[model samples]
Target chain A: MSEYIISLAGLTKKYGALTAVDRLDLSIRKGEVFGLLGPNGAGKSTTILMMLGLTEPTSGSVQVCGIDATMHPVEVKRKAGYLPDEVGFYEHRSGLENLLYTARLNRIPVQEATERAYLLLKRVGLYEVAHKKTRTYSRGMRQRLGLADVLIKNPEVIILDEPTLGIDPRGVREFLDLIVQLSREEKITVLLSSHHLHQVQQVCDRVGIFVGGRLLAEGDIPTLSEKLFAGEPYIIEAGVQPLPDTARLQTVLQDIEGIRSIQFSEGLFRIGCQRDLTSAIAGAIVRSGLALTHLQRKTYGLDDIYNRYFEGGPVYEQTA
Target chain B: MIFITATLKEDLSMNRLLNIVALLKAPPAATGRAPHPFRAIVDKEVSDHLRSWRFNILLVLILLTCFGSLYISVTNIGKAVKPDDPDGAFFFLKLFTASDGTLPPFHVLIGFLGPLLGISLGFDAINSEQNGGTLSRIMAQPIHRDYLINGKFVASLIVISVLFFALGFLVMGLGLIIIGVPPTAGEFLRIIFFILLNILYVAFWLNLSILFSVLLRQAATSALAGIAVWLFFTIFYQIIIKLVAKALMPSEMASGQAVLHYQELILNLFRIVPSQLFSDATTTLLMPSVRSLGPLTMEQVYGAIPSPLPLGQSLLIVWPQLTGLIASTVVCFALSYFSFMKREIRPR
Candidate 1:
């Protein structure tokens, strides 16, 4: 029942013969921390740009909060905040000055914009260097300043492309914390694209993995795990197993509905079942007089899903 | 009813917020009413230019050149009163001497200093902005693309006018110190008129520089193009006209008559280049000896290209050339603006 903040329906962008985004259909819910997980040149940035109305889509539609971005980009832009991967600013101006300039561009009153600029600078931990010219700022400081610039308008949706790309570990942690704070406190829907799988896994409530300019898989982490590893069995280890005949065990496990295969090695029996049938198979195993010592459910993480989908695979099934 | 209802439902709060945001987005007001965005862009451009050591040194060099030329005039006057060297005195009097055998008038220094100042101020206006990455940012603003070019053209004109006034004051101060006779009001007005005409001449270069800037993005390339254009009008343009006239005019005409005929042809051809027109206009204004040019007789010179025409007429006579310069500036600006707006801001 969540509100749909942004939607891209069959979005495709082509640069000459190369398709940057191919029929990308995505829906990000209001106030959710959504991650677009993809490697370099996977059309992640292109998709974000299209959503921002900064780049035109070759075909398809982008709607932000029910307003078509292509039809009314300025209106959509007013409602959304975007942080490009490589944020650039007028280097001669001070950090505060740059933010103030962006604020004015965003239409904040001068006095209030100044106050808000100071507050945002403080929030981003850039207050100490606010007076220093941007040319003097480091990459991490610049990124943080870029974030502060986006925050000035108090946008409904925040889109950050590679927000933590060049930051140190500590800076990344702070940046992620701020993103989480924005989503949780401000009720801001966030569509973050990053190559950092671990960070995305840590922060994103739901994620969409894109490979070759198409969404390969998408859902909540556990849901995506289940979807990707569907039909891959759970491994069950028993301590009291003297030995069960492999054929018999396979037969017994397979006799149960949804169990496709069972194999035993090193005092462990691996049972493959239809997704969501793990508990049923485990119950059947318990009833078969096997003392279950360990039970572990295996699911693919973002990295595994990324490699499986993007690297080599069944070529026909690959999204591209 | 439906349309009215839809319009009423349109989020006024959000629209108001956006308007407020737009206002807040402007750069800190440096001068005037936020300078129409293009002005800020042009101001930043001019400031960035004036920051360079080369331009600073150029300004210093100009100041030195003007004063140095003035000093030479003063010392020549001192040398002219040798009492024994009558021919030298006459030579000095003809060129450097005032009606009295004293310091040279302001026009003498202006004649030498004006073109140098005009050429120096305007030869790089557009090219430097393109090189500095300001053109793209300026064009990205909502203001019309032509504004940036026009604003730059206008800004450079203002800068040239200020420089002219500065030079004029310097010469006047020096003239007072050396000549010891304050200029009459008419003479002072004439000097001011000549300075203003020099500004128009500089505008031609500024406009031409902008045209080249749009035509070429590289600062060096635009600058080279501007200098080449200046050289063409100052030197090659006249030579070409002479050669063409000699080939076409009848052999029956006397040499002096042919020369006059060739001069008229060259002047007409030169008018196509705004800088040449500007120079011609200023020369007529500053030098009393240039009473008539080509088919224009002495009476015609007074009626058509007189020394002290009203400001409006002066502007009007050169209006076509000024319009050409202004139009060229606008066109260059429009091209740059359109190209920049359409260009993808992709990371290089």
Candidate 2:
């Protein structure tokens, strides 16, 4: 089993009467792309800050790379890289200069820092614009520069908050690819938080869904999907050919026990059923004698699991 | 045992060699080789301030005030010494007037220019960092919070000192060129002391301004608060003190004696205020023979007046007030550092 590289135990942070993060416990293992998925104001940034040792947690403790973050924040910080959500740079400094300053802050020597900064800038596709003041850089370029700054220290664990925010699709893809490459080549642990589930789904090995300052669920995609959907499976097809009406499909599937919900796509039928109803669903499809070209259990994506776990109804309603 | 010791020695040497190689391969320090944290911080602050337009405007304003005061002094110097007058040599005495005689030239400049530079340099020192989103980033480094505040304070003091010396020398050079006669050694020493006091007084204001900057979050608010405080000290504070003294003290005493008694009471009360103490100390330094600004009796003037206190005593007298300014500056900075350390770096 892989050892956990970062751990938070019973962590709680309170601002006056408001609890920004409450009784949070997380354990991220080495070399895993762990995505923190949440909506706005979901305490994602607060959690990240606590991990980075920038904010004091009101209770409990955090350990990064076996070092107690609260007790030894400097050591923890030395081994961890943080990219804040809205990355701000010294406007008077060039992009390369800003990265070099960060490198120096991490105690890197000047000559090597300059060379590494130039290499990172080039890696982020910003070498040509290295000499320009950060104020003149576009949001995308600035975001890339922020990434480059974080990489200057060659940290073991990278904590990126909203890494893809304010970036175009192309930039986002390139960023994701870079992150994947980092994980594979450098054995770096990544904790990425984003509101974009599709992007999270594309890269994360495991995902945690946070809502209202509480982590609702966390698991690999399949495990989370199984938990949220209660092991119910579905079949989906995509094509512009007319399918049976929803009522007819419901009628046909209702008599077959263990089937739960029947949804109709444009030219397809999505059949959701109980854990042991896959065989029954196939039989019913065969009995209906409709051209059953595609019959397979469908896996839920991160979006479906996110919606199931976090949307519409509160996880627990206290009010009568 | 000997074999084990040899293995241990070899391992230690190899580890030391690897550590040295790592240090060599690491990035160079940003400012130069062996970047001292204090120097890096000072250089960064100076460069950043120089790049800012507000600092440029402040520089222009300081130059204008410096040259403006000097020009007025040069034009008015000769008037004090009328042409074909028999006491032309004593015209220098006219330059040292109080209510009894004039003030020294540099003293007048200090009284006028100290606050301008002090308030301008420091009113936005902390607030601008808070506004610019750099405060947290700086604090996040491994350095202690006090280092950041101390570094900034020292950098500002250096900048103010440089500006004062530049202006002081320029004025002295102009005086030499315009007035053909070089100042006496005593006059030159007195001017140098006057410049030192002026810089110290300005440093006091800078400390106060930094205190206000720490208290206020926005740059505009801090600047406005500092200027408002300055205005109260410069204009309304003395008037309030006088009115309070009149209402509180006995007023039916003999006329000239009442003036002396009232002046003493007001001066005492004013000593509690920093600006007043600074002004009184500076005025005393400039005019060595000033007994009082109140009405003076001929008997009292004729009697053997005591010699002026030495410069060390003057500094000792104002030491509490200076300490008060520094203490307040530190208190404000500590509060700011605490709050800044606690504040979440979120979008407004």
Candidate 3:
């Protein structure tokens, strides 16, 4: 068996003169939770649709579970489930019935479909309202139901587009947790696309950063940061009481081997370093006779990486 | 002893199946076929249309047209039949399509009701799904796009066909109770054919409305376009056809052949309208005593028989009209299928 379960090769989609998704090659391993992060119109949805065989790609191929999605969409779909952004169920149907409807479309037997639907509904915390009409459910409940709906068929691969869009912070956290559980506990491969940086950071094992139909960066968050922000230095922030000693603090750290630059303002010293030097910096501050109020090493998060690329950093412009 | 043992085994298996169904929610159906993926779509669409306010309103409208026209037909059939024969042999059938002094025949009533009912069910069929953001979600399922739209159409057709058949039988049963005379086998067969054609006539409009639903992005615009086409066919078309016929006719029609030629042209023009097709088929089927609807010279009718025509003869006479309705319905459906397949499902 191939290591990757979902693969896209030279995938491109064009709507007349506008290319929605340019030539992109991507592959996700089995049981991996992959996140696709990009701004609106970055072609994330188009790419997801292409992956599901819902939209035809102009020049590319998508294979899910070793099945060519374009040639045999039904076979690909049988093993994969997709949850579109802003999930809408049949308003008149209850949550359970709606899932059953989807189950029926997958050609599952009626009796067995009913059982799985109820079990998944309970797992998603919607069992109590399973019989209630979907229209009456809150947006969060609907989103959770959407999760359960995709899981009804017990697909090997799940793709969710903008899963936390327009959701509250708490709901977003719960959804992210559910996604982690799906990948970690159930061993289901997941492909999640979202605008929420924190959600992607929290759930995804790997992420692809897209911009203007092009994949700018694709890897783990730290790897992307290291590669794209190579020239940029890590920051260690320290707060000291008695601001009169700021000059003394800078002179003590000036001769350190890996320390690149030092800036002091308002009793706060920010030391830029080539690597993690929290211990050495703390010792130097102690030696300089300054009481450390706050000492924290700030890692480069996905937000900083996104901003650097999105703001047209050197790497972004070079690729563009 | 054998029966008891067999029953026990069956009960255990049935319980096990139910348990799995409840627990799993969607075990594949135990059948040779792939469990017809479109079945659920059809069922959901059927239930949705049945429970919707729009469908209910259209149902009420059709019922009002049926019962109102039935009331008029019963009195008219009584007077139109021979005075000595208080009840005609084809009593139930005439009770359905006969006209009174006040109202047109039951066929005309259906002509007005069927298309509107079909349009109301289908005008927003596709676009409303898109507007609600459900189109993409449904498309995400294992089923193809063909199943979704075709299932919708099939569901609506099933509902409307059932409704029309029920109404037809209700009128027939009412007529039987009132006149106390059951229609002959021929009359029964003819009414069944009329009901089938009625379904086909409405199917044309259903396809037309679904086509609009596919072509137009807004629900309201598709609905308005459907109504506009319906209005053009029903009201304005005849006027235009009449004016065109008058202009094309000779200045002075001094001979019988001239009048016949003018009348043939007008009849051909009327045949183009779907409602005319429906009514023409219904008139031949329900009023079997009438041999022809076209103008004939005196010599041509000199030896014509007065007896009611046989069912086969009536069908042969209206075969062109029936084919026209079916052909147009298929044409509309083909157009809808083509556009829906070619359409990109993106929300743009």
Best by lDDT: 3
Sort by DockQ, top down from the best: 3, 2, 1
- Chain A only: TM-score of every candidate? 0.79, 0.86, 0.85
Model 3 spans > 4 angstroms off: A236-297, A315-320, B1-34, B83-91, B253-261
TM-score of each: 0.67, 0.81, 0.86
Per-residue error for B309 in candidate 1, Å, reads: 6.0
> Model 3 over residues B167-257: C-alpha lDDT tens digits?
8898888888877788888888998898898898889999999999999999999989999999998889989998898788876736877
Query: In model 3, what is the error at residue B315, expressed in angstroms?
Result: 1.3
lDDT, model 1, position B299:
51
Considering only the true interface residues, what is the Cα RMSD of candidate 2 after superposition?
A: 9.4
User: What tens digits encode model 3's per-residue C-alpha lDDT throughout A136-218?
Assistant: 99888988999988888778899998988878999889888988886776678999998778889988999999988888889
Ranking by lDDT: 3, 2, 1
Ranking by TM-score: 3, 2, 1
Provide DockQ values for all models, in the order shown. Answer: 0.07, 0.15, 0.42
lDDT of 2 by residue, B13-56 (tens): 66765553354234334535646555667776777666778668
Clashes of each: 9, 13, 20
Residue A53 lDDT, candidate 2, scale 0-100 = 75
* Of candidates 3 and 1, the better by TM-score: 3
TM-score of 3: 0.86
Q: How much lDDT does each candidate structure score?
A: 0.65, 0.70, 0.82
Candidate 1: which stretches are off by over 4 Å? A9-12, A58-61, A65-76, A233-297, A315-320, B1-55, B69-274, B288-317
Per-residue C-alpha lDDT of model 1 across residues B149-255, encoded as one tens digit per residue = 56656666767777778877777777677767566564566567666666655555555566566556566776677677667766787788778766767566567
